[model samples]
Target: MATLDHILRPLPLLFIIFVISSLHVLPASATSSDKLKTATTIRKVNRKGPYVGLVTVIETEEDAFLASVEFRPDPNHPFIDLSGRRFRIGKIHGKKVMYVRCGRGMVNAAAATQQMIDVFDVKGIVHFGIAGNINNSMSIGDVSIPNQITNAGLWDWLNPDKAEGSDNEAYLDIGNYNVPQSDGNNNMLGSLRYGHEQLYSVNGHISSPQNVFWINTTQEWLHLAADLEKMELLQCVNASLCLPEKPKLVVGLKAATANIFVDNAVYRDFLYDTFEVSSSDMESSAVAMTCVSNGYPVIVIRGLSDLAGAQTGTNAIRKFGSLAAANTARAVLEFIKKLPSNYNVNS
Candidate 1:
């Protein structure tokens, strides 16, 4: 009886300890909440300033540009571990720059631009890649530096009944109903939300509000691009092949951005006629909006790989995509060389 009593006395102490441990344990929901809080704190603390941002849309475009410059792995870069994405620190004409492939759409572009602004000290952004030509005058491989960029997908979908008194009997309007009033900072301080119910029949997922607009490229950058001497652009993909004509650089044109990959001639004409856009792409406008929000001046240089369905034969992107990418990279590198090191955004 005495030995049994001794064992039961230790059992009560052990049970008490177990109860205390359970009391200290966090609930699963609370643990998840704490993890989210920790991640948010990390992102806020990782904010960085005062660097040039270079972005491309895909691996091929990124590879083409990287081939032009000697870059090395930035060991201390936080985003280096991300798979299937390219991030490097490189010099173009002796200017230090951060190059990243922003993936291939409006969402990815916006996210990459925001990440650059949040994690790096980006004072200005220079985006370069290939685009579908909206203008018939432009030929394949010609480079276009757009002065203005607009989100072509953001629009007010009006019922036909509501369009009776409108100037044009159109069912769609240019401005979004949910767009916030400008905060007087060049109309760059607003948010864009996807109207999934109005625009699509899929699972209604509304995008978090983001900056979107007809943002203009930095005038200083545009001026620098205008003074650039035409460099020799790639005219052939291989030893036995060559393009019909040499490509020329065109600056100060308008560009439009959409979530859709536009390959239809009717839509191409609409974009040209409505917005006077010389080129159409998937990412530029989103990049511009993010730059505007972060007070980083931005510029876009795109090479024409296709005529946005104006061509009759095989798609130009399939044949001349590499050439277009190379030309844009060359033009951007030249512009970087000419840009003054002491140039200030406020000045």
Candidate 2:
């Protein structure tokens, strides 16, 4: 017969074995094998040059940028359509770059951003466009290089009649929006709101269920953009049309992105009060999220085209969109020249 001490000693070893068997841990070799497969897949793609990818949310923005700088198309491969989106390989300011259009809405923007990154050896990304101004201090045509950004589109819409059930944390109650449907009889509800899109990484780069709230711009790039604070912006759409105030460059604030175009004062106020965001756009946060996830650096430059919903009359984006686009392009060009000739993409 075994002694009591001997039986207890063996129990510890047996317990360790049981725990090890019960855990869903992948074998070390499996992780290594998966990494190898990923690397191989990337290598098989025949990706293009390591270039700084340029993106704009709409065609108007692209037109303005093209007018501001020369983007000579690569002779060998000028452009390609990948997943119903066009990617143009080119050189801007004598530096290799690829341009892609981030169509309206978050889905389009995310798809285009990831497509560019996957199809090309993207070193870094620079996204520029026009947006609605939320900060009262900023005027139309003012360029904003926000230090932080997030997708405020994510929500936990709740039924007004029911008690809140989920244990998840939420911010802001955007209720009283009993808007009648355009065709349907039911009214649209705006009950609750939350920030931060949640995701899990398969590559084990990030912890499981990462709550992405504010995606901070690359510190170095933001610092470089800060140097442009003194840069002058166009105050006039033309000789006949000029903004009441001279536009200026604003830096180090926050911006919000969503699929919905916000042209309501109530919603604009809510965004500013809740997120402290200076500007709102349809695409920036999606691009930022994609680049950050891919282990690359990215920054956004936006020119205020309208006062969201606080304007005295109709939206000013259409009237001043061209001016705002041109101003944003100017800022991007200046920012590009500030980049070091040889930069570590990872850095």
Candidate 3:
């Protein structure tokens, strides 16, 4: 005669009980569409083991990983071999790890993530990349740590004229629009729909007024959430399913953004005046979304890389980018160092 609230008191252990008991409790008698509409809290689990530290850096050059490698020294490194095309393995913080270059796209990022989890045995991933700023509050060197990431570009392609799918097929629902599902996996292909709590927990200014000014409103700035905010997070979240045993995973890091052309005054001015975007580059949103859904912790540390309307802000870009990345990396390392060798956080 336990109430739902009483029964749910120990929710953290639910995942283990569900798995051990092999219970396939259907979605509360609701249809898949209904389930989609409903929000779900991702379960988190932390187990005891030799604490390992990991950091992922998204850089233009292959050598970026090497730079990070020097920071953490491990001779017997764990490697991720992507066949002949990409073979990378290393150790950081004296723990096993892998470094990969997820070529710029959702599919590639998804594939690489899967390989890392499945093959390399990475507990958590830190996606380091760059992203653009759309809020005037941002300066040439500021960092954005987003609490939630929505697929901004997900809904722009609903051409009724081009609707060509089997009548029986269900279109992928990405918030407002439905897109064709190219990936068979549910986690990787669909649009992000974070729970209200998670969305509200995020701190920053998004174009969506609903998601703006949730927690810790330190700075004042506004940025428009664009349509194509990169489709990589879903892929990372999906990759979690592939793990034989789901672990409490964390996806963390920062990103900087600017105009498409690193050095285009016209584009910069357009972004600043119209979008009120601070800086522009690429990648943090994807990383943030993936981390949240996978039931892993994430923290974004960004630095402003460009001015509102500078023709080319490479100088500012490099300085800020490096500063942000360094600080983020240090923070991540510090967090890892704090974890005890016998730390056990229930998932």
Better of 1 and 3 by lDDT: 1
Give the candidates in order of TM-score, highest first. Answer: 2, 1, 3
Stretches of model 2 off by over 4 angstroms after superposition: 1-48, 163-171, 174-190, 201-207, 343-347
lDDT of 3 by residue, 176-236 (tens): 2324533433333343221222332233345332432112211111121111122111101
Q: How do the residues 303-340 of candidate 1 rate in per-residue lDDT, one tens digit apiece?
A: 99888888897677988888899888888888877888
Per-model TM values vs. the true structure: 0.70, 0.78, 0.43
- Global lDDT for candidate 1? 0.69
Q: Model 3: residues >4 Å from true position, as ranges?
A: 1-65, 68-70, 83-96, 157-281, 290-294, 299-303, 308-332, 338-347
lDDT of 1 at 163: 23
Each candidate's lDDT (Cα)? 0.69, 0.76, 0.36
Ranking by lDDT: 2, 1, 3
Which regions in candidate 1 have their CA more than 4 angstroms from the true location?
1-49, 70-79, 82-85, 164-213, 343-347
Worst 10 residues of 1 by lDDT: 194-203
